[model samples]
Target: MSKKVIHKANTRGHANHGWLDSHHTFSFARYYNPERMNFGLLRVLNDDIVAPGMGFGAHPHDNMEIISIPLSGELAHQDSTGNKKVIKTNDVQIMSAGSGLTHSEFNNSKTDQVNFLQIWVFPKEQDITPRYEQKTFNPADRQNKLQTVVGPEKDAENIWINQDAWFTLGSLKTGFSEDYKLHKTGNGVYAFVLEGEVEIDGEKLSKRDGMGISDTENVSIKASSDAELLLMEIPMR
Candidate 1:
């Protein structure tokens, strides 16, 4: 087993748009912080809460793999590729903005807020072809266990990307523990807690806290409370 590397990132970058409140766990465009740039190939992780009837306008992207996980409410997505969809809690969406693509996301409800996590990862190879996909997963599948949501397989239940990385989600009951083995020897896992508390690799992580662990074959997680967590395993270098 390789040595484990651990640290709690200094959370930075926050923008409140009256309708949308967002927090950047890593450096993002227009919210740059060199010290919090990235964790391995996990480039961006944005925690967003969109007020009813509001969301991001149409935007363009290129050469990046994007994943959106909804925590609550509903997200309406449309793209130049002629795709239109609504994503709710337990739903996952991925867009391979290979070469280039244009898209827009909005909250579909007018009376409730929508909270979601938007993540971006660097692709192993760039400029392939633009693609989009979305899937609604059964929350029970992640109850007290990790469920693989994204991977390099076309047959995966969720969206597929162009890299060897994998994304998993888990919801642990209080006092429950689970172990996750890394997907690749040279890759690392970035764990993010969405609710409750968790102990990972001997470190404690509270709600909204994140940690990156690499150079290890596996890591264990013990929940202090009923908790929801996301783990992204990607290349380290």
Candidate 2:
């Protein structure tokens, strides 16, 4: 039997520091939810708003796939791999923290707050080599359809991670519909709505809403209004 989990927009854990406002979909930092820990191999999912000139300091990670998706403003990233870059809207950044790595992120603009999503997934194979990658995605390519932004293929037009999971983005017009098929059996899909409203199968979701669909090959998504969306397919193990 297929299983589904719906996460409401406001049901997530929220933390407010002087320079950071973050919402945790899974247990992280100070917010611990035994029931919300993880879905399949997907680990951390954090929606963050970083105040200008403020952000996370150097942090260490190992044997994890870390992905960052910027929504607005600029995010400056610096890592131990000698990679320093600024990520803007529609840009995706990924790091394979194999073995170990340290990095920091900050809002580049002096007056603008930067909003972004930080996600982590367990690696299929651990302790290989630390690596960093980022890319700019043309939003037009995702208009009314899915645009793959992260995958396992090196020749693909997206960032590659150290796992079999795939991440995609979509922008749909009102009343438009789309379908997403899993790349591998036993993999689950996590669909998130960034703007407007949408329906997965027959369940309605709104801005900042998320849904996990498993035990199925594909899912039907319908937009009730113009909507921006993200979909992640991950291994069930």
TM-score of each: 0.94, 0.99
| lDDT tens readout by residue for model 1, 1-237 | 554444343455888879888889887767887777888888899999999999889999999999999999999999989999999888899999999989999999999999999999998789988999888888899898899999998886767988889999998999988789887888889989888899998788888888888888898989998998988998998
Residue lDDT tens for model 2, 1-237: 778999898999999997999999888999998999998999989999999999999999999999999999999999998999999998999999999999999999999999999999999888979999999999999999999999999889899988999999999999988678889999999988999999998899999999999999989999999999999999989
In the predicted model 1, the residue pairs found to clash are none
lDDT of 1: 0.87
lDDT of 2: 0.94
Give lDDT per model, in order.
Answer: 0.87, 0.94
By summed lDDT, which 10 consecutive residues of candidate 2 come out lowest? 175-184
Clashes of each: 0, 0
- Candidate 2: TM-score? 0.99
Best by lDDT: 2
Candidate 1: worst 10 consecutive residues by lDDT?
Answer: 1-10
